[model samples]
Target: MAKERALRRAAREAEAAKQRARRARIVARRQRRRALLTRLMPRRRRTGRLLVRRSRGQRAGIAVVTLVLLALVWFLVDDIALRLVLTLLGLLCLPALVVVALGRRTS
Candidate 1:
């Protein structure tokens, strides 16, 4: 009975060790895959502050309007130099324009 008990205990211990090793391998493979994926397609870190404090919809609206205006300028303007200047000016003035246009009206 004593010998049989010792043999059973050793068998259980060996099975447990094999399970531990299998889990370690799985974990290592997952880690390696994650590392490779991260290296290949790294996520962009949002470290810098957004210039405009607006909701996603608001920002999208502003971008659409800006693009429309630029497109109009591009199509309507005959001179390349004038078109370039206007586009640059529009972009430069966008922040101030947004603030003024969307500012709270004090009654």
Candidate 2:
């Protein structure tokens, strides 16, 4: 009975060690991949000014189109018909316009 218990204990210890080693190997592999990616990636070097880039331009264009659409809605609904709804819609779109304007001004 003593020998059986000792053998079971040894097997449990061996299993625990294997788990720890496997975890360590996974962690090491992740670290190595991260290192490789960092080494391979290229860094950008800007010369003169920070630009708006394409995404910002597209956002600004969308804002302009939306503003035009809102204006058209207001024009078509000019008899105070759904005035409150139109006002709320304009208010909701205001932040997007401001964001695009500010982004354009900055970049």
Candidate 3:
């Protein structure tokens, strides 16, 4: 009876050790996958950090669109003073539009 009990306990201990090793491997694999995903993914900037990157072509495109939109608004309005005000407002918004088009990034 004593020999039998010792044999059973040793088997149980070996099984438990195998289970522990399996769990450790699973955890390591998950951590590696997480690290790989993070490396591949693009990092996002915080809300307070609002720097945008604009290529030369993109900047020109934004400028052209802003001008065209401003011109259309000016042509639609009948009153000269109102047209001037709208144009000025559009001009003020030009930078903002470009910034939006450029897209925000941390790096």
User: Which candidate comes out best when scored by lDDT?
Assistant: 1
Q: 37-97 in candidate 2: lDDT tens per residue?
A: 9899996656554543536676577667777877887788866768668878777877676
**How well is each residue in 46-97 modelled by candidate 1, as lDDT tens digits?**
6466743576787898999999999999999999999999999999999899
Evaluate residue 19 in candidate 3 and report its C-alpha lDDT on the 0 to 100 scale: 100
**What is candidate 3's CA lDDT for residue 68?**
91
Q: Which regions of candidate 2 fall more than 4 Å away from where they truly are?
A: 43-51, 54-69, 76-107
TM-score of each: 0.48, 0.45, 0.45
Which 10-residue span in candidate 2 carries the lowest summed lDDT?
45-54
- TM-score, predicted candidate 2 vs. hidden true structure: 0.45
Candidate 3: worst-modelled 10 consecutive residues by lDDT: 46-55
Evaluated against the true structure, the overall lDDT of model 1 is 0.90
Candidate 2 C-alpha error for residue 7, in Å: 1.5
Candidate 3 lDDT score at position 98: 59
lDDT for model 3 comes to 0.82
Of the pair 1 and 3, which is ahead by lDDT? 1
Best by TM-score, which number? 1
lDDT of 1 at 63: 95
TM-score of 3: 0.45
Q: Give the Cα lDDT of each candidate.
A: 0.90, 0.77, 0.82
- The pairs that clash in candidate 2 are none
